[model samples]
Target: MPVHQRPFLALGLRLGAALAMSSLYMLVKLVHQMGVSLPEIIFWRQAGALPLLLGWILLRGQMWQLKTTRFKSHATRSLMGMVGMLANFGATILLPLAVATILGFTTPMFAVVLSALFLREKPGRWRGLAVALGFAGVLVIARPGAMPISPIGALVGLASGFMVAVVSIQLRDMGRTETPLSVVFYFSLVGTVLMLPTLPFTMTHHTPLQWAMILAMGSIGTLAQLLLTAALRYGPVSTVVVMDYSSLIWTTLYGWLVFHQMPPASTWLGAPLVVAAGLVIVWRERVRARAAATPPEESAPAGRVPRGR
Candidate 1:
């Protein structure tokens, strides 16, 4: 089947993936609160996923999928991804879940600008407008003087989104030649290696319950990433990404239930605007994709019959 043909199914998968990710972040925040350092969390997170990913490749007899000429590119992508993930997790730990998640929504806006700069894909007027409106929503959420949210936390969150956007660019470049499995495996591998040295200092003794939560966080996060990758492979990023907004819903619900923290009025006010802008951007993308897929009009000389005629 054509990749874009079953977008609704892809949408479901993306939404599910987002929910899983939201849950994972909540767990990460819980463990961090329990005195786990970021490096240790990242190490176990990457390490936990390694076995499942490798097992999948083995079971599917797709070990050759690991072969690639793009090792350098993969390393670069992994480095960016690790930094982005850490920043995002840090924001999650430092800020209220809802606020951090709203800031994370800025990724699409950053992706629009980055695609124009790095990939030479110009976002047309509609998308440009969407980016502006999205940033406006960000400004509303981040009205720094009032101090409803920490300026530093907000900045870190936005930086995380920006770094994730950079990773997206590298993923796009890598997607041209590499399998998604290969890309994910290398990311986990490199991320694990990068976090390993710090693990000595970062590690701490844990109770059985704490250990279980840590393992669960890593397993869920890894599966969520795989689901997200598959969702995009089966659908356009525009379509799949719209479903990611549902993460806010998951985070909001979980934040209240688990942490007893409700989002302030500003978050409620700003988040929908950002989401609306993102949806508009997605609509524009779909229109553009359809236009690109369409054949241009063809005409015959006035005196001649058309082939179908």
Candidate 2:
């Protein structure tokens, strides 16, 4: 419970969460390779998480907290989340895991732009520069003229990040009044319901092993979200956000081990730019937060000004 230890605990939790999420992405690719359609895979994913979320709400006696004052906001947020999920799944099917994972790191970059546009939260010089660098990194990985990987897949991954950014803005607005559990519960519920129709036609019979992998993928996803949330709750976002980049390591390992695919030179070269950009954004935000937390000289009451002045 010590203040100093929280950062260490948060870092570990974020690392674990990143590993679990990387595993989930790899599982999605596995199921896609197994011939399941995207809709059905998405349906199962949402369905799998639904139970865990609902159980938590019920067990915590927090069902009353699930009530939402902003149904429209929840619906909008869920819609954006579903689209992001679709794009993410598509990227996994189309691109190598490591490449897709790295591209997804652009979420923070896109979030800065979107926050300015929608939330009117303007980024300072450092974040603006970081966003620019992030886009340049995307260009390096994408390489439109002399494509290293599937260009379409790379674009889809970037699009997914943008969609997630949009959804984050919505969540930020809703979080003003909504409980965290309510936001997650509604998103899971909505995503499941939205993808339900495809289940009947797209669901194919699978072996017991395949079924287990599918379910495990969904369960691991739920666990990943829980760990990520807990990490943010315990430590500053800057500390925890940096740990998310560890997904690149996990995904690269998973790619090599499971699919015998290693990232090309471009990924190795470009990923650092993107990761660095994201870290800059986090650092800038941390500086701003600390600045806000400290009182200005003029705000000091009476002659209480320190001798440092």
Top candidate when judged by lDDT against the true structure: 1
Which stretches of model 2 miss by more than 4 angstroms?
1-12, 55-62, 119-122, 172-179, 232-239, 298-309
Structural similarity to truth (TM-score) of each candidate: 0.89, 0.85
**Predicted candidate 2 versus true structure: per-residue lDDT over 1-309, tens digit per residue:** 233227788889889988988999999999889888889989988888988888878898888878867888888888888998899889988999999998989988987887688788878778999999998988888888887899889889999888856764565455456666677778788999998988889999998888998899889877876676556556665567788888888889999999999877888788889999999998887776666677786445677753210
Backbone clash pairs for candidate 1 read none
Q: Write the per-residue lDDT of candidate 1 for residues 104-221, one digit (tens) a residue.
A: 8888888888878878887878888889998888888888799888888889889988986677556655655677788888999999998888977879999999999988997898
Residue 15 CA error for candidate 1 (Å)? 1.8
lDDT value, candidate 2, whole model = 0.82
What are the clashing pairs of model 2? none
**Whole-model lDDT values for every prediction:** 0.83, 0.82
